[model samples]
Target chain A: MKIKSLTMILLAGTLAACSGTEEKPVDQNTPLPEVETVEDEAITAIPDDVDDGNAIDGGSDDLSFLEILDDPTSPLSNTTVYFGFDQHDVSGEYAPTLDAHAAFLMEHADLQVVLEGYADERGTPEYNLALGEKRAIAVRDYLQVLGVSANQIEMVSYGEENPVAEGHNEAAWAQNRRVKLAYSGR
Target chain B: MIRVNVFFILVVLCGFNAAVVKADLTFVVTDYVEDAIPIAVVPFQWKGKGQLPGDMAKVIDSDLSRSGQFKSMSRNKMSSKPHSPSDVQFAQWKRQGMDYLVIGSITPKEASRYSIRFYLYDVIKKTQVAAYTLPIHRRVFRKAAHRISDIIYQKITGEKGAFDTRIAYVTVEKRKKRRLYRLKIADSDGHNPKTMITKSNSILSPAWSPKGDKIAYVSFETRRPRIYIQEVATGKRTRLPSFKGINSAPSWSPDGRKLAVVLSYGKNPDIYIYDLRSRKFKRITRHYGIDTEPTWTPDGKSIVFTSDRGGSPQIYEVAATGGRAKRVSFEGSYNARPRVSPDSRKIVMVHRDRGSKKFQISVLDRETRSTLVLTSGALDESPSFSPNGRMIIYSTAGTRSRNILAAVSIDGLVHQRLAVQRGSVREPAWSPFSRR
Candidate 1:
């Protein structure tokens, strides 16, 4: 009976050790798969603009610098996109700008764009940072739906740290809450 | 004629019932010590032609109760509502076991102008202990009530009251498509908010000078965030030196000669002290990562700021002349906004847990290096202490999608919300003690 009791204790210790080791390895390894799934879902959500190849083949390689600058229909031109107060949701009026930018991205596959998100100064600095990030991500997601590659675009949230207007009135606030599209690389 | 007499008798009964209802307005102070001094706040007599708008007695009652020093009795047990010290019957209050009785009356001085005369009496001694009169307009009746509370508080505790001071905070209101930014200055108890600065551009980090004559804050008015100092008494402002890169996090020195701020004009953000007397800026910290949120020690010899030069953000202190910064907080992964207490012995900062999920306001004992968490909320930041170092005011969010300014005693016992509406209010900077 004593020998049997000793064997039982030894088996319990080994099982405990095995369980502890198993948990440590699994905990360390599980986050990568979860991240991969999130990324995969994001990729699948991309729009048909990139798949159709109509968005990137429009810009001519033979155009001179002055002609490119003078082109009124160039997607490379700057445009203003508006967002709601304390929110990063793309407004209904600004959807067309994203669509145009997506078309530009499809036409110029070599050109990279950066989305700069800003908030009106009203909330805490840290919260504004997060809000700005949300605004930039929202715009990026919409552009992705238009078939723009996620890798070709970068997003940065300036929060309320940058503003285009100085007035405290409604007009100024509307101007301050925006995401600007800037071309980074040719 | 007989019907008229019957009507008069019914009117008299109704008047008596109204008087009884008015008598129910008494003040009680709870949460006191074992041998707390018993005080009573009598029903504030209306001096206006119309009925009183708000409960003045209740405001005074709660203000004194939250101090944790006085024991106020219930109004139901009061003998009478005396308009002044002469009208008070000392024997009645003495019989009810009240050591002190407060009597006050409001008298209309002019059109919508009123003066509140209040008296504190020692019932046992049968003599008036204190008497004062405050003249106020109809719009400031609540402030007069708080002023009366301050008087009573000072008489009993021998410490000056903070009721008359003001607090400056940032208020964010979202319109249909734009976010509005407003810098509001309100009474210390969060009443009578007046907008000092309003802009669509974001404003943050308001710091009051030691003299309380001017305020320094960060504004994004010029397309980029820059520090601006505005005079409180006069509507004058002065912009600080704007460099090429980042300009944020402004803190005033104790003597008001230099302003400690963070500037990333070079490579990375570092602490810089701008001397007001010389009008010259000097970089105090040279670090690779972010070193911001500079707060001066009371003595003006050292500065305590947040720096991630140690891998993660932690509280560090360096000489005003700038040298090696010694890390003060070691337990938390994130500790920022280090506000030194009035006595300069304790440091209050926002501390984040290991995973950075929960952020709380904590007090670090400088002597022992032991930390005490003062708040348990999900996110509580920007803690500024009252001038006397007895209480701290910080911002926290509750049930709704709004930020609320809250205050608690340094010991974390007394807690109260400052805002009345459901809008977001944050970055509370407490004013210095009133000069009198």
Candidate 2:
């Protein structure tokens, strides 16, 4: 099963890379495939509930947020949330994962997470830094609205530096324009 | 590939052997003027020397050719090497299609000084235009060549030459999983390069003071961006206030008393004046949007900066003391990293063309209200004007996926690329004219 999943991921990567270079004309009739694929991946990755055998159910909370977030097989394992070019608004697609994080933070008073926002290497350095900060702050605000404490979140913006992918193309840029949720205490 | 790598390593190692290692950047003219006047710079005759103090003639030749105003004849193409006008056959030069001729001779004097004599002749008019004899120290021999070029350039073009200047640039090298960033300063002709500061983290936005004695740059050595001023001669650095959020985009005021920096300790990234004398921070812009890359006007009365309050990044101007900001660039949807010209009439930035994906350098004329694209690149940034306001040096992606430095004439007539053998060069700041 693992080998099969790896093969599928490699296939998807190849097709996406080729399509990115060819830049096939999009038809108004057909839906955007990449966005749909991204949404499907995000949806299938997360679990409906955080209930697990390791959860300390004797307490008021029935499930452990940190355990679910740390579990590789869980949907909450995906720590990075991507954004559009020059955009700071969080899309509704990340709602489930953000909800899981908010619940976890609220349950554990000592838990803290750092939202490191980054922008693609497109605009000026200083302005991109501002945009990055805004993206992290936007994520922080959403988490706060979902019941996460303000003190639990710390924001930092790397701007266009420290890109995960190095190419000057859209695929690389998409991977770079993101905010990574780095949780403390392992 | 193996052979090329070996050769590159050897070149870099040789450059690293000197006491003060120099990484010279040679220029390849990518564009030129159509009606460039032809000129010949004869190799200077060196007496009682194993080698001349420096290649004075070659320096002058490169400077003139890089300007796009003149085409220098190669030494191999010249029929004779003349040290003075007495040995010059004007008719021979005219036959070779050269309009002007320059000849010089170098002689060592007492106490490590050199006496130099040079003459510029107008071949078309068949008369000597100017001649000079000066004694200079051995350490300043390269500068002497630039001075000669300056004299010739001013006589011919009736404009001050910017040959005798320095350029401060940033270089980044990826070493395995780590990146090394170095702030390098070099002669304007791309010689005698010395690394001013090297850090394990990132460094950006180097701004040379008006006096050229200090440089202000942003360093992420502490894991957060902080502005620091480093004296050029002594290599002394003083860290400014870090504040809460971002501290970046440091631009020195005209008189060097203040630095316009973008700090986000407040609600948003806004321009703030950090007075050097009093060491106080005075807010300049109060907008909630991002205001960055502030450059002072020549007269020091106003500052032009990049702001996104208009929905997209655009150049805007505000009073130095503080007032309502006015938009300066209207045509482009993405214009940022503004650098005002020495004349205070034009501003340049990394402009993203409307409806296009590529980023390029562009200039805006305040008086004419017209913008001209000066470069064609996938990414061109940090457009800084020369001290004379004639040429602009910027950073662009060159071959091999490396960011190399480039210079373009204000009219976009002449273009030269300054490509290093390794790493990436960026954030070039041309120094003001030296007092000497």
Q: For every model shown, what is its TM-score relative to the native structure?
A: 0.65, 0.85
For every prediction, compared with the true complex, DockQ reads 0.03, 0.11
DockQ of 2: 0.11
User: What's the lDDT for residue A34 in model 1?
Assistant: 19
For candidate 1, the lDDT comes to: 0.68
Q: What's the CA error at residue A148 for candidate 2, in Å?
A: 2.9
- Predicted candidate 1, C-alpha RMSD: 19.8
| Recovered share of real interface contacts in candidate 2 | 0.22
Candidate 1 lDDT, tens digit per residue, B1-436? 0111111000111212122222111112212344557888887787666666456676676567656555678788886888865678888888888888887777878777877787888888988879988887867666777788888888867876777677888887768657777887776655556777988767788999998888899876654456889998775888875642356778899988889987653234668788787666676776655577899999999999887667666899998987778999988777878899998999998887777556788899998998888777766888998887877888876555466777766776555555435456788899887664
Q: What is the TM-score of chain B in candidate 2?
A: 0.93
Where does candidate 1 stray beyond 4 Å? A1-186, B1-38, B44-59, B66-71, B74-76, B84-99, B105-117, B122-129, B133-145, B420-422
**Per-residue lDDT of model 2, residues B1-436, tens digit only:** 0111111111122212233336567666777777777999998888755655666787788788777778888789988999967798999999999999999899999998999999999999999999999799988877888888889999888888999899999888999998888999998877788889999877999999999999999887766667899999999999875554578999999999999998774136878788787666777776667788899999999989998888889999998988778998988779999988888888888998789888999999988969999888978888899998999999998776578999988888777788685898888999999887
Quote the lDDT for A186 in model 1: 32
Which residue pairs clash in candidate 1? A55-A106, A55-A107, A56-A106, A56-A107, A57-A107, A121-B202, A168-B199
Error of 2 at A92 (Å): 1.4
Best by lDDT: 2
Q: Listing candidates in order, what is each one's chain A TM-score?
A: 0.60, 0.63
